[model samples]
Target: MTVSHLFMQNYTGPLMIALQYNDLFDLDSISTSTDTDALPNGRAFTFIKAVQTVNERLVEQNKSDCLLFEVILISKECSEEIKMKVDESVKHYGLEIGKFFFCKKEELINTLQSNKVKLFLSTERDDVYEALHTGIPAALLYDQADDHVLNQLKVIFSGDVIGFSEDSLDGLSEFGFSETQIETIKTAKICMKEFAVLIGQMRRRFGQENSPLCTCVLTSWGSRNVCASALKTLREWGLDVDEAFCLAGAPCSPILAVVKPHILWDGGLLNMS
Candidate 1:
């Protein structure tokens, strides 16, 4: 069955709000006034209100269709309370929803394909590319002047990291993120580029050997593009690698290919002894 999935690209603020406050207090809890400090961050609370408004709009627009909303809850606030709140929110709004959480790199791509997600609420350009390349329509969830990658996507509303694109990764002097996010992206990009190079080198070395391990990476479902790009660079470098292969029914699509040769070793880098 060909299912067209629609995912909301999560804005960090609203997502954080949904996790922190919603998990702690729901309509029932809030109605009962049991938790006064339920919402710790005022900004997150405001963002939640805005998100609810958007959800209401979605309900109004698709009144007749069976709306299945898939939310990728990739935040630091992954607690039982957050989970309950996310589930409750969807149920309360009457939306059929599938939710996944990520704190690692291997699950990003897997989730995208499994969901068959057509639209996104996450503004991460790399994540957007993961969806786009896999045939999903992605958009920014909020607005910001600093999001250069918005041009690369069908940007909806925008704010914070949800506004950034690959282009936003460049020109750190003028990037919108605070020093912390900028540093985080900078470190991650460096690691990503380095990982790509390492994989490429490994492929080359494996091709020269007759007894290479038939190995496959169980990559993160949500971060498939970064891994894919790294693998692609490996292929381009003339390494015969069986690409990162995922299990059947897994969210991550596994790439199975034979490794090629002609990869030059630099300073005995390929020797694992």
Candidate 2:
């Protein structure tokens, strides 16, 4: 789409987006640096691409006002390391890094309680859930083929979150939040406990072994673009692997509500659709 594409309304000023590091990084190995050479392989490149797509749509939505973004990094640990590594790619892409905070987890809620923060994106977390429940527009990003994150995103972003796939990029071209809509969201109340209970119920219902027995090993890195075929081979062994989910774009809660397979893999399988 071009800048002339028709949109519902216009958005003024630069939109601020919050990116949490813990959700993007491997918590176990804090020393592992990002492989900046190949993109999508690294979280920074994926986020940059999404931002570019959103900005392109922004141009179309508000032609008179140039679309701009201020990205802030949120982290409870390894803030300095994440900033240093991601800055290389961020500068290379010509995007500005607004602020980087590596405070305690509890402090995260207070940090994001700002009028400027239009949206928050991260993997699923209790704090993020609470933020959304309180009316802050947010989206959860997950790479594993599991129902847990997918189920939550369906409820939260129904129309707000950005995904890491090409399809999600196209979806960005179509939607932009309105101030009035955001106001409605602010007053909207979704209890955290309610969602937590739903997720637990889903887990117990679907996140279990359909057959008390199976054998399969699935990788959680990115889209499983690395060493994924091995898992597909296991699908042939009748070890009870779900080939349908092998190449699927993570787990989608909407999909889970429909198709129930005998075997689910990766870390997210424990979450119900």
Candidate 3:
């Protein structure tokens, strides 16, 4: 007998946060203790309080990793005013601005389709329409803003990443985290049996957009060696190294397609080769 799947089975419960090329960036680890040094940073006014609460719960219950920059789509040339506002909000919420890459509109149209990029808060509604027509998830940044492409950012802050989209007011949804809040459960890949169980669960929780569970392998690999090789490769590709990271972790599995993921990484030049 064919079992019909439920309509909201994918996101009916708790939501997940992850990325596609997850290993490329290090996820945030938010500590919400009122006594923690970072608590002051999150005091900035934003709707990220619910996410903060969720992170607190994760730290208490399952030690889940927090997000850094969940990748926001925006104009490369956003206004200074809007940029300051968004930037302050991010810092107030204890979020970091890892890096920004600029893509020309025409170039984007050619590349975005293959990349399966979601249409973002942008100044060009026509481009937004084009992106949406391609079956990508696109949306206007906000209600009022300049119509120019380079002058307006229509900032889409990563803190706006929501775990649940339920009924809301003030244009924000209530966070759905509850006693059943999802957390990253630790499972060792040391043994075949343990490994199989971990993989099975990854399959089950893999596709949902808001799935909170994430898996990563920890290894004793030399950071200097790996980072040096990476620097060489990138430089060889004609890219200058403004910053480098020797992150320690195994290659992680990609997240589901529906929920586009963003990454945040450190800055500074590295000569650890």
Please tell me which predicted candidate would have the highest TM-score against the true structure.
2
Residue pairs in clash, model 3: 15-210, 16-210, 16-211, 16-212, 71-262
Q: What TM-score would every model get versus the actual structure?
A: 0.29, 0.43, 0.27
Model 2 accuracy (lDDT, Cα): 0.40
TM-score of 2: 0.43
Candidate 2, which segments miss by more than 4 Å at Cα? 1-11, 24-45, 60-69, 92-96, 144-273
- Candidate 2 lDDT, 1-273, residue by residue in tens: 322121212333455667776444344343554555311223333453444444454455556544355678787655555556655545655655688777787777677776356566665544445566666645444334332222221222111111123333233233453443333333322221222222222222223333211122333222443324433322222222332233233545554444322122111122222
The C-alpha stretches of model 1 lying farther than 4 A from their native spots are: 1-36, 39-64, 67-103, 144-273
Worst 10 residues of 1 by lDDT: 264-273
Ranking of all candidate structures by their lDDT, best first: 2, 1, 3
Question: What does the lDDT read for residue 131 in candidate 2?
Answer: 66
List, residue by residue over 1-273, the lDDT tens digit for candidate 1: 111111111211111111222221233443443322242222122223333343454445555423322334444334565555545554554432335454435565555455444334343445543443444443323322222221111111111111124554444435243554454443433223322233333223334333222223322221445445534443443333443442222332122112111111110111100
The candidate with the higher TM-score, 1 or 3, is: 1
For residue 253, model 1's alpha carbon misses the true position, in angstroms, by: 37
Candidate 1 has an lDDT of 0.32
lDDT of 1 at 270: 11
C-alpha lDDT values of all predictions: 0.32, 0.40, 0.27
